[model samples]
Target: MNTDSKKINTSRISISELMLPSHSNFSGKIHGGYILSLMDKIAFACASKYSGRYCVTASVDTVDFLSPIEVGELVTLKACVNYVGRSSMVVGIRVISQNIQTGKIKHSNSSYFTMVAKDDDGNTVAVPRPILTTLDEVRRFYDSLRRIKAKKEHMEDTNSFDHTSREALDRLSDYGAILTL
Candidate 1:
């Protein structure tokens, strides 16, 4: 019944930067932590742009590094609002690296960041619901819904499951874990 909704396209953001030696780890590859900082920045921007309010990161639901980024490569991060739930929005981000010289591009990472709109007083505020306009938008929203459900269920199980139960101990043995407990 809420008429304050925005299309998915209006919440998209992209940023690009050259990976420098300062952003590299000891392994000579771009640091994952550095990339995560940029992701958080873009996710906040996308969520705030869509919600018309300040947004803070609630959690990073997923981050997968598929390829290592080199120091000299140009890294581009794209973020979009995939789903919205009351005060929260799931921002999907994709990271790509391009060899500026060879023009080869690599998909380095994909991640989901959950952001919550907030008021100036630091209280949670309602966000504008996302209006899915395309098939891809619909698919992304559904996928995020499923992932959030699974994460909640998994957390519940983890919180209630007995780690010292007989079956649990037996399963640990299968993993060759030496239990000192």
Candidate 2:
């Protein structure tokens, strides 16, 4: 682990953009894909700023769109480094949309992005540790730890479980999936 550490607030970032018609879907609401792309950019920026190295997104977890954003609304995204390993960081992002006319703000989405730091040689590099100060920051760190553990356990279960077993095949009907085999 790298001994270098930085305060959590150092790398926190916030950005806002006015939603336009071009950014909307057929339903006249802002597109979820566009919001996801914005989230990715913010995650990359937050992780890179924290790590002081180029970072690549490894995965995105739990993108839940909570509200619809109107085309004329202003969308704001806030990103912060939630947790860090030797070479990886989890960035938590929250999206909110505000009706400029009514001054009403609604939470649009929340997501977690996992990013890996890389050196110029394309090798993984250790990132600076995060110095958490607030209770919310501590809670985010612990939540990230639990999420990581759950991911590992899920992968292990997937690797060891037998999908072709008779019991497993019989249970497919419970999910409304028909086995053509």
Candidate 3:
């Protein structure tokens, strides 16, 4: 475990790969699952580098696919440690795709991956805190804080929610889910 905190930029990583036809789906677009796999790999690399320990992805907070990537485009993924707790860190990732010929670039995806540091024994270990040096870094840190808070509240609400209740059942129609029960 790192005794001192690490700067957010210290562990930043960027990787770019050319999209190939084999990476595309039936729709002839780049596959979302393939991009997600790449994101997960980069997230793990960033978090592990920041914490100086092996890391495992605990959860993927959000993955928004904003634009479609062409098979011939170059896809780049950037990752950095956005926030850190005692044993976990949120790695923020941004993906962009660029056309080699036209030099056109499009934002393809944005996501957050929560990773937990682990010891050689496979036990959870302490991770170094993130040092925020810029306003953007501070904003990301606080945003992660809010996301964690909201997630906890949502889990609590879900646990106590009565889906079988008449009110809840009535709301099923709003989502277009048929209530056969």
User: How big is the positional error of residue 176 in model 1, measured in Å on the Cα after superposition?
Assistant: 0.6
* Candidate 2 structure, TM-score to reference: 0.95
lDDT of 1 by residue, 65-174 (tens): 99999999999999999999999999999999999999999999999999999999999998876778899999999999899999999999999999879889878978
Which wins on TM-score, candidate 1 or candidate 3? Answer: 1
Residue 160 Cα positional deviation in candidate 3, in Å, after optimal superposition: 0.9
Best by lDDT: 2
lDDT per residue for candidate 2 within 1-181, as digits (tens), equals 3469888777799999999999999999999999999999999999999999999999999888899999999999999999999999999999999999999999999999999999999999999878998999999999999999999999999999999999999999999999999
The TM-scores, one per candidate, come to 0.95, 0.95, 0.94
Give the TM-score comparing model 3 with the true structure, all chains together. Answer: 0.94
lDDT of 3 by residue, 20-118 (tens): 999999999999999999999999999988999999999998788999999999999999998899999999999999999999999999999999999
Off by over 4 Å in 2: 1-3
Number of colliding residue pairs in model 2: 0
lDDT of 1: 0.93
Angstrom error of the Cα, residue 53, model 3: value is 0.7
In candidate 3, where is summed lDDT lowest over 10 consecutive residues?
1-10
Q: How accurate locally, in lDDT, is each candidate? A: 0.93, 0.95, 0.93
Clash counts for the predictions, in order: 0, 0, 0
Return whichever of 2 and 3 wins on TM-score. Answer: 2
